[model samples]
Target chain A: MRLARVIGTVVATRKEESLIGFKLLVIEEMDPREERPTNNRLVAVDTLGAGEGDVVLWVQGGAARVISEEHRKAPLDVAIVGIIDAVDIADE
Target chain B: MRLARVIGTVVATRKEESLIGFKLLVIEEMDPREERPTNNRLVAVDTLGAGEGDVVLWVQGGAARVISEEHRKAPLDVAIVGIIDAVDIADE
Candidate 1:
């Protein structure tokens, strides 16, 4: 998983039949150090009720595509894995 | 899979038993457009014999950890999935 901030939303008129009702959120990649935004952006599926400007943990690839055994073949590439409540990076 | 250029290699003296003999590559993430280098960096296992400076495709999460049925429980989070031969971004 990686840190990202939900910036906006995506509306696709046509998509995979399996992904019809999934809400897509636009997310800007965040630097792991301080959660500062990066130049890169990605669209992620939201099933956790994450709203705009929410900080989230997103996963990519096979993990994102397979939300369940039945959805294993979904074409999704990114998913909002979790919403960040707090972060505690220990000093080394 | 995502595009990444292997920038360096990782040498871990002590690691998980499953990852002991694996070669680890340090990769800098790339932007989807023209494969421009991004600020993000990741350490990925190289089972495909990817070398430094090689442009490769990588996968994250379960796709990475489960190289095979035997290594399904490996703690790895990234893997070099393929070496990119070419990219063809069509004009829209």
Candidate 2:
């Protein structure tokens, strides 16, 4: 999974039948330092009630298919599965 | 799976019931180009015990749950499944 922040929402009227009920979010890649965001952006399937400005955890590829159980042909390369409130990084 | 190094670890106190004893790692997302680290990072479930600077392969979504078989409500989107010493991206 990667760290990303939901920047916007994607509206796709024509999509796969399996993806009809799933929400799509436009996420801007983020730095692990929790600094500024990056230029790259990705569209991900959201199932955890994430919204714009929320830091989220997203999965990609076959792993995504296993989570949402939808969007067989929805053309998504990423999926948001969780909303992260805090991270403790001192005990690595 | 993407290439990443274990930069640190995460410890959550009030986590979901299913994630009582799982280990989480702080990962830095690397550019596929292998250029200098992109300054991007992630927190992932570590089943392989990857150490700092070890490039690892991670699974997300249900694939992660199937691999770790824990964290039923732990809200993890990334799980480190294999430790990668090298990658031959030339074939991609």
Best by DockQ: 2
Top lDDT model: 1
For model 2, the local distance difference test gives: 0.67
lDDT for B61 (candidate 2): 62
Question: Which stretches of model 1 miss by more than 4 angstroms?
Answer: B1-63, B67-92
Cα TM-score of candidate 1: 0.54
Q: Which digits, one per residue and each the tens of the lDDT, describe model 1 over residues A1-92?
A: 56688999879898788787788999998765445888889998887788888777666766565455434566777877556664433232
lDDT tens per residue, model 2, A1-92: 66688999879898777678888889997766654687879888876678889877666765565543354455666777556666544434
Q: Which candidate is the best by TM-score?
A: 2
Docking outcome class, model 2: acceptable
Tens-place lDDT digits, model 2, residues B30-82: 76666346665777888666887787776556556666445433445678878
Clashing pairs in 1: none
The DockQ figures for the candidates are 0.07, 0.28
Interface RMSD of each: 10.0, 4.7
Q: At residue B35, what lDDT does model 2 achieve?
A: 35
